[model samples]
Target chain A: MTKTRTMLAAFAVGLLTSTAALAGDVRIMWYSDGVEGEVLKDLMDRFMKDNPDIKVVIDNVSFSVVREQLPVQLEAGDGPDIARLANLKALSKHWLDLRPLVAEPAYWDKNFGDQADWMRPDGSNQISGFMTQVTLTGGFANKTLFDQAGVALPGKDATWDDWAKASKQVAESQQIPFPMALDRSGHRLTAPDLSFGANYIGADGKPAPLDDGAKGFISKFIGWIEDGTMSKDIWVSAAGSTYRAGADDFINGQVAFYYSGSWQVPNFSTKIGSNFDWVATGSPCGPANCTGMPGGAGLVAIKYTKNPKDVAKVMDYLASEPIVKEFSERTLFLPAHKGVIEKGLNFKTDDAQAKAALGIFVTASTGLSDIARKLPGWAWSDTVYGALVTRVSQAAAGEMTLDEAYSRIDADIAAKVKDSAL
Target chain B: MAEISRQTSQRRIGQSLGETAMVPVSLAMGLIDAPLRWVQKTFGLGGMAAFFLLPNMLIFGIFVLLPFFINFAYSMTGGTALFLSDRTFVGVDQYARLFDCANYLNPNTCAEDTFWTAVSNTGWFVILQVTLMIGFSLVTALILNRELMARSFWRAVFFFPVLLSPVVVGLIWKWILQRQGLLNFGLFGFGFEPHVWLNDRNWAFAATVGVSIWAHMGFYTLIILAGLQAIPKDLYEAAEMDGTRAMRVFTRITLPLLMPNLLVVIVLVLIRAVQIFDEVYVLTGGGPGTSTLFVTQYIYETGFAAQLRNPGLAAAASILMGLVLVVLTLVQLGLSRSRDKKGARK
Candidate 1:
């Protein structure tokens, strides 16, 4: 009888201690583009050493999980304590407001204030999250390929046509498959669209129809695919708005010019590594303006977290000026923190090309169009983007006419809007 | 005399130990025996059968029937919400939207053009895949059933793909088909121009059909081979004795005997062809402009993968696909019943 009593007592104690331990646990769902996962893990280890009572666990996952699965998890009111998300504006309602929970609301406001609206509900002063990096959609040129082909890289004020023509020349001379290849992503496409003076927003603050500016660029894009000036493999390889990057083709020297984004800096720095020379060309000029879309992934606290206080602590530590500066430097990500940006970062990389590319992206960030600036916080941006990618790819594949694709884009966005209506 | 006595003593001890081990089992039976007896007395033997089936029925209801009902409910609602409680009831509006087409023939006229395009693609895929799958599987099975050298090795070679995961099958074929892949290298070596096989619409569609057939034909071949082996060998012997031609003998004896298996294979192949997604999705990603897009992938992307998902629309599309599968299943059941009835008559 005494032995049984002791066993039951031990079990009860174990359960109580485990529950207490779990109460302090903070889980973060993270996805990385480059070596950021490792950088963050190192920082997290240091954080745990300092705050032993508050356990921080990082769940490393693919970008697809963050894009596709995390939204579903959030919708079901079940997810990690925090998540690093790219579609921050669309899922803003599910985020925890750290204004009350954080140690100093003014600190957060002064540091992350500029981009806070991009990850919170409209008309709310909620300090929801902070952008881990500031990304701008742009172009990268394979300098080695151009050099091998005896073709000079286009000038700074070069138009999309000039770049396309020059890249095609280099591709032909080098006997490579793709002259130019843009990532099969809506965000990537929008840089060129905005440069062509495409306005995605209307007077009602809803998605506008595909205007002449958008059509002009898209029609040209489709023609390039048809004429083999652009890589058809990237665009038509998938259907229905599925994202595919042409970085591999570019890295492999098959593509002369690749249009992706600033986020590919570290990825190319790590993967391309002296195999070939590359340089960021920023976005090419259009009839309207030379511009690129402004966007990035943000780390946000989920409202459904049981350990809100612990989550706030972790967020506070990660959002500190010194920590953000260190993270940006080590990961080679462009910092979004105002203080960190003002202080300027010495990006920790030996790759001259990567350093130059980072400098180019920072310069490109200043030339962003007004529409591009607003798009990151716009609720209907993703809706428009999804429609553009789906229909434009179809047109490129000769499945439909460019005019039909434009019509379909409008209809698809309208349907999405209606479907989202309460 | 002492050894025999010792052996008898050992045998007695073993028996005693066996009985002692059964004590717990006997006690367990005794504990439940009374309740079981009472249940049988109150409800009769028919109810006892149902009582025994209760656990499986409960599982089926919770996992299968419950989700199915919830899915049907989702079909009747509209919203971007993942949970049913948060969604608004739209009462078949989602289905109406799917059917809201200016012209049924051209997907361009449909409100949901991608869905219609997928349906058309799936239809073509089913016809080509089912016909070719049966023809190839039947031929392979016949070849394997013959008295050939390394017969077991040949069977294993044919059955290898069936054991592979669909994703592995897709990746293997993709490596061979992509630009700069082995096929292109071989073509270049042979002084022929290398073509991008997966980038062209016609080639992409054909690849999806061909790859799916390759991945799945092995399983069907094994089934047909089993049916082939089950045939009475003496029938072939008698045909030879009568100086019957090979073709005539096969048409008369082999095909007649294989009819039941063939019917089963046809139904199975047809059903599977309609439900195809994973291997094809990985292979073509429903592209070179939605040319390889199928019904299952359409439902998946609409519900889950899209930037702003419409679960209601996806659920409606799924319910429609389910109805098509239901009709296919009924046909299979009818064919199976007729086959059973013919056996009964015989």
Candidate 2:
């Protein structure tokens, strides 16, 4: 018995010693739309090879999981050391201020510029992280369908009604089932919503959603749905702020016009090759202005991580000019790094359509309204967006009248803001 | 006579094998009893039971009871903060928010209309899903219990869908029911218009209920089948000997004998229907303007799905849902007990 006990104790001690020998591990919670996750993994592999004392684990999670699970995990003090997050304003408090820890703070300020401020709460000049890809929400059309239908493509300054009429004509002529579809995201909808002169953020810096401009846009949107210019499938098919992508419908050549964003450029470039001619255009006009929303996902280091220095190291490497350039060129993302953007991305795409689409989106980014730029960085932007989409969707589905929806949007946004108390 | 003697010999052999197998088991029990007996002597029978149950009790208390109490505490707080320290104690504000309606029946006049919509949808879903689920299960159980060819194979086939994950079941049905899906294709082939199954409000709600029944009918059928087997053969035999009809026999014998199991199925299906999330969520996502949204989906969305996670509001909604479930379970149990007494008296 004594001999057996000694053997067990020795085995346990050896197990503990073996476990202690391995280096400290850092987990990066990541999600990808295309190839960015793979690009980051490749970069991290190089980091691991050089710095063998630190191990990095890339937890490839879904976008929904990142949105729904990451905040809960962060609040519980058990989030990953680094994570790719889109809802930066919502999770601003939990971000580790990388300015103090990064290798060269000036490099971030120079390249990222005002982009880093989007991840900071309340417009404070604290640097949190750099943008993975600068995204501009806009519209794309099946130009082939338009040509076949002999319906002329609406120009840059065309009104929303003009685009709708053109798209409907194209669909009718070609027998396309869905004339228009938009990504069922509240953020995506804001491009058009803001064009109707709806100032989502009031002068007092609160979400006041029910201004006359907003009501006019929502009422027009409801009219479009009723008239079948926009399919209810993408808008009213899901409930209560649930996001549904219409990329498949667009790619399948079943939809004549799809309103999504620049983030879809790579996907459409790859998937719709030699199938249908698609084009990304500037935002269609409303009464106020023709502009799209400027938004992007960020890779922020979490505050509660045990290895802040290691995380900073990874961030610095990723934010390096060469790495950022290569990542943007390969992933077909607009470079957030000012130097990379100025140096001109040798955007390695042979597809003329993709190149043209990129040019249009880049131009559109410049023409975005000041409100669009500020909306993404606002603290309660999500609350404002969520309230608008949920109530407006209900109205579109005929569950409530337009007046009731506007009132509800106002009440819901107010309640949500008060409830959060941020 | 030869068969009977062979069976008697086989029974003796089985008894001998059973005794052989129990030797080590009995020895192990004897070894365990020494400490147990000492404990009992020192304390009492209650102490012995308590000692035996300590591990399970600790597990339940720490995991189940702890979370439940935490949820109760969370329901009293407010804010999008996930941690209790970050939350503000709002007392009954969350509950009040949920119950703030102009008319109890009209969800349209409510402050938090989504919650009421979910409740109304769930109420309709339960009424429809439970009734149809029970009826179909009973019918399937009766058919399977017959002296049909390949009965076991048919039984297995009926229970096959139950083995699949809820997500899988939902996806399979979704693929069949989508706009360009097999059902539409087949309908087009048959000279019919392709109807949108999941995109239409009423159709989406119906599809959710129908797919739920298809996925879960097998489980309840298995239960009812077991109960059908437990019914006495002699009662059916005597009924067959009489001039009683098939309908009368089924009504008198099979249904009455199956009441206890039927009650179990009803209560179980009721609780499960109220807790329905995974299947309907995957199938419809409570869509076409919240027509198929259930209370559980509402709670989940409030707490997690949204960018602003309102755990306090979600917790309050969940507690109210729990109260509803508790009331349903009590009513079901009372009905079951009363029926059992009536059966005993008979």
Candidate 3:
């Protein structure tokens, strides 16, 4: 946290003294789920105190509202200096060009090191923005429950099928009501594909471009849930709070294994660290190697910038160890830098298993962009997930078989593709 | 004959000399007045009226009228925030897009669901709300008018919701309906599953309507009570003497007397009902797939949400809705006029 504040202070100073014509006031539009808005305010105050020539104004809107309103405000000529956006769908439509703004690529590479490839969604040499932090959603298991069920962690040799078998054993033990709880939220499904080097089709902006070995892995992950190894009811929330409730149920000893993204790591450690021991691992893979779901929002400078040079400098500094480490340590997020994690931040968990999980994420997936953003049928995925969950629930209730559920989802996907001939 | 002719000529000569100067003076006055009359008629009175109403008119024009008109214009243009540099002015495109949204977003709503939802929701609300509000107040006024119980205490109790803020009402109800909230605690005590009332579609809709009634009924109740008290008691007394009973007297006299107040109440309630925004926005946010999404929320979504940054489309929808409401109001006015004529005939 101290590192984070100091880094913010330094970054603010750089922003203040830089060449800004008319010492123009920068109105930044941002979003707030919690203390992010407050942290931005702190950053602003530090900037304004040093410069005093330029005033920094902040308008924090809801995440969903900001998502919908950013383009609207920009069109109306009322957008802020900076905004936070979820990296969703292809940058094909709302692409930003930071090439002309930032420091030269050689200099950026010297400072940021090898970790900047994750920022380029299109995989082009064009670095649109700098990622503040990175997070990957994989599989997390409870060590205590694993021991109680007499099941062992699937090491490097084991695959997802073995993991499911172990999970089935844990469920048969029944002390844990559910063996695995799968989060069917749009982003996390990519984790299943990533565990075995697969990507959601259309995630990358191209035609019929599925990952190296995706279809088989997708079927198995779907099979695990459909085969009763994982329960959709434990994780899915149509209107109720779905995110924490799964972890809450798991932490409270209702479930054995929880599958979710890296965002809720703090929530898990804070809530359940003292009571039960847990293990985090690269999700067990289906084939060659374990992988992770790769998605992170980047801080892009708008084309209508007053000082592209300065904005580029800030981006460069933000990618630097001094800035990125501070942002990570204070924000309780995974550092985007390579050696920063070696010099630890505030990941206060006593359990060795949780530490192992963090290590797995670091090793499992190269900091690469997932393909779902460019996928043609994100709407289709929603329809599929919605339909699949309903059918799977019916199957769980003895209304259909595993084969029947899979066939239904497969048919829907095919039909959706045909309709979208788009 | 010579003497009479001389007298007549003498009189004519005298009259012509006296009145001849007045004719040219009158002609000049009329000629001078013509341009002054035209200028005053064209600019002065009209300008002053506009000037007097200008502050409000300008405010209405800038905030409400301009936004509505501009939203319609922009909806046609299909311009976005990031692409204003290369925006095209496409006409009637947004109205066509509304059908597209209806087709994709809602199968049933393609024709006029968005507009009609706001209308029917407002309509049903007006009917039940006005009837219940007026009825409760009338009953209370009757009881208070009677030599009976603590009228002031009950009046305050009923009117308390009117005093509390709607935001406060929304927040309090939100707290009460949350998963671990007061409602769930009660449900748990009775061995029932604690439903997520505010989050669910059907329950969320009901809760919004319920909160609306709870917050607004108090004001309407007070107004109806005031109307009820103003009715003359002699007619009721005379009816009672002539063997007409309580219900009979209420229908014949109290109701007839209250028509003017009732008409005012109806119009105000209808107007207010058409523009229900805050509670719904703060409450459910039109979630669970837009089951409770009203026209105002939809317009806000289109204009400001950046979800679909075609303000022109939102503006077109608004104009259409405004026209619908205007026509509906005119019909209400026509009904009231007929009622007045019938009352005068009686």
Candidate 4:
């Protein structure tokens, strides 16, 4: 009996020692949207081969489905080891110190890799995101429609005022209901408003409420509606988004343009095959500068993870230049890593059009990340920006004036702050 | 003999309490006996039966009762009263916040304010849906009450949708309600233009209502079918002697007879509609810009959406919803009793 007890104890100790040596599998909660998730799966497949014991369990939920389910899971202490969060707001409630996990500063600095300081969880000037993809949303033009209208192709130097004039001319020439079909989504509507310079939230170093930028953006926005260059009917119409079937609508000459995110390239490349030409470009600059909404998913670790070092190692692998290149290039997204311009996705078949899209990003005067517009839950931007879309659409339909719509949206945003403050 | 009798008592007690409570159920089931014997042999007494019951109470307290009490605690606070630990305890603030509405978005419609609008919309839906459900089900049950028709065939047809998952139902409805869907195709064939059912605010409500009715009609139809068959045929025969026609017999006898089953149907529909997140989620996604945004989805968005995870506010909203549901159910029960009294008096 004594010998058996000793042997069993020795066996238990042996098992524990072996467990200590083995690299533990990091639990990853990666939710993908569109093509990024598929690309991520491919990257992880390679990572697992490199570290056979370090398995990554990728739970890919629909973009919206995970948004709804994440907070509850995080709160319940059941969140994945790492998550691919599309918006920065994912960092607000749950944060992990990623500084130590990230490659040395020398490596990051030498590469010219820059993720704006605001992406951090604590918002105290630390890099938190493992990766970020460059997204150009808010301006896409149908080449066929422009060619049919005999409109001159838009140049890089075109300002918002110039673009608006050209767009109106194109619409009049084509005799379509309206040429540009920019969605009146709160985020889309307000991105132009903010990029034109609106002081939405009361962050330090920003202007006071209802600042000059806000007034300017609103005025330009209202003018766009009144001029009928942009139509509310497009937002309300039963058209396909840049994906699925509705994309064919713009390609087939039902509408002149479809302004959506860069994700549309893969769908268009496949479906819009030789039907019509198209170009993705930066948002129109008024007098200030041309800016586009910079957003893409980031991988983040949970706060209370036990084996954080191993988890960080897994995250490091995900954010490596090799994997980042695989993702960005396959998906045709702008690389989150610095100096990765030459290494990105081949989402489009047409090299010329792809260059046109990439050229717009490369030449953009500025890039701002205002991606919170799409993620609905607990998001100040979506709440405020969504209200702008709702009320503005109402205003565009002649239900209210632009001034009324702005005031209502401001009031709604303020009300949200008041409710969310607690 | 006493040991056998005691064993039987133990088994019966264990089954009943074990069936209900799971801990006292152990004692009734004799899981307590082993521990009881261990304690008895160690301490030379069986008085630790109370001690043996402690684990059950502890598990129940930790899992079930704790949440219930904490929810009650959070109910008293305003804005994120949930207890994942960060929320401050603000007494009566959550309950009081419910009363404030001047700051509400749609000033013209107080009754149509976010929470109240959800309430009335949910109420109206429950009414229309439940009435139609019970009415159609009761009528089907009447038809299938006898061997006159193929009862099983008709029951299967009515019960088919009940077997279908809510997600499938929502998806099926999405395809049907799309502008180029079967409904539109038929309308186009009849020389009508295609209309976006889920797009227009006016028609969006109708679209949701139609989906709800289509998805749920089969469930209650089956239940009412069962209820109709269970009604004693003597009552119908007795009423027929008064020179009553089939319609009159149904109105006078069948309607009153199916009230209990109808009440169950209403309760189920009300519970289901108030929690109507999934179908509303898939069909409209609360758009043409939030015309379809129900309170449940709004609660989820407010507290848990990726950008904004205000769990305290979500808990506050949930507590508020729970109170409102409880009060509404109570009021419903009270009114139902009053109606029963009036019926008795008549």
- Identify the leading candidate in terms of TM-score: 2
Q: Which digits, one per residue and each the tens of the lDDT, describe model 1 over residues A1-422?
A: 99999999999999999999999999999999999999999999999999999999899999988888999899999999999989999999999999999999999998888899999999999999899998998899999989999999999989999999999999889999889999998998998998899999999999988898998899999999999999999999989988898989988889999998999999999999999999999999999999998999999999999999999999999999999999999999999999888878999999999999999999989987899999999999888989999999999989999889988899899989988995
Across residues B1-346, which tens digit of lDDT does each residue of candidate 2 receive? 9999999999999999999999999999999889888999998988989998999999999998898889999999998888888889999999999999999799988988999999999999999999999999999999999999999999999899999999998889888988888999999999999998887888889999899898989999999999999999999999999978999999999998899999999999999999999988888788878888899999999998876778999999999998899999999989988997997898
Give the candidate order by descending DockQ: 1, 2, 4, 3
Q: Could you tell me the lDDT of residue B120 within candidate 1? A: 96
Worst 10 residues of 1 chain B by lDDT: B279-288
Ranking by lDDT: 1, 2, 4, 3
Give residue A374's error in model 2 in angstroms. 0.9
Q: How do the residues B1-346 of candidate 4 rate in per-residue lDDT, one tens digit apiece?
A: 9999999999999898767786676667596578768877776655476566789999999997797677666555444323436565677665455455664555323311345445555656666666666667666766766686676887777778877887888788878877557888889999998876876766876777777777777777777776787789888778778778988887788777777777777777777777777776677665554455667765665555524344544556677776767776887798679878988999
Which regions of candidate 1 fall more than 4 Å away from where they truly are?
A1-14, B1-37
lDDT of 3 by residue, B70-106 (tens): 5555556655433423556667766765554344443
Off by over 4 Å in 2: A1-23, B1-20, B46-54
- Place model 1 in a CAPRI quality band: high
In the range A294-331, model 4's lDDT, one tens digit per residue, is 55566677776766777777767766677667667677
Model 1 preserves the real interface contacts to a fraction of 0.87
DockQ of each: 0.81, 0.68, 0.10, 0.19
- TM-score for candidate 4, please give it: 0.78
- Cα lDDT of model 2 by residue, A323-348, tens digit: 88989888899988999888899777
Tell me the deviation in Å of residue A61 in model 4.
Answer: 2.0
Best by DockQ: 1
